[model samples]
Target: MTQEQVTEFFHQQLGTNACLEAEGYTIDDPPSLDTFIDSYMSGQDIWLAYGSLPVLSQQEWYRIQEVCPQP
Candidate 1:
């Protein structure tokens, strides 16, 4: 994935960075393109320092297949 794809995937999975801030989570600006692609392919749970928020907060891949209605 490109940096754009990585960023979009992040937002798709975990909403906007500002939305996260509203929920009390702090996220740094995304890194370089290659870095983002690496992270995206790593299958790692990229951590955001969100103390005091509920531990149940989670994210999933925002798949396109579930969006458009079928005929």
Candidate 2:
């Protein structure tokens, strides 16, 4: 799922909203699992991740969960 999401997010689309569509799994950043996944997946943000405090989007969050799931 994460690989698919990454492919879609990069080669398939450009917009944040478009990249994170049609996928499953809730990633609202609530549960401790989500937070853990978020931190691990933060490494994937080489392009858009910037600023002193980078605020990720819903798509980015979803992508993170998709790629970096909780063990």
Candidate 3:
């Protein structure tokens, strides 16, 4: 999905509590997965990833799982 789509999903799921404490920043009005990825790549903070991976390619699903381990 696109960054805008991801952001909208989080906005719905997180509501007012969407801000990640560990990340020390509230999600932008609309979260951008690309922006989040950039920050994470730079080691700025952990990005919250939310979505279903079954629809993605095997490699993509594995990568997402690796980044966000299941509880």
The prediction achieving the highest lDDT against the true structure is 1
Tens digit per residue, CA lDDT, model 2, 1-71: 47445444333222332323324422222223343345446764323211112456988766655654322
For model 2, give the 10-residue run with minimal summed lDDT. Answer: 45-54
CA lDDT, every model vs. true structure: 0.47, 0.38, 0.45
Q: Where is model 1 poorest over a 10-residue stretch in terms of lDDT?
A: 62-71
RMSD of each: 8.7, 13.6, 11.8
TM-score of 1: 0.34
Instruction: Give lDDT tens digits, candidate 3, residues 1-71.
Output: 45565456445444423323233333434346566545545667533434312266888656644644432
- How many steric overlaps are in each model, in order? 0, 0, 0
Least accurate stretch of 10 residues (summed lDDT) in model 3?
16-25
Give TM per candidate.
0.34, 0.23, 0.27
**TM-score, structure 3 vs. true:** 0.27
1 or 2, greater by lDDT: 1
Pull out the clashing pairs in model 3. none
lDDT of 1 by residue, 1-71 (tens): 66677666655534444455554555666455456557667965553323223444234123211231111
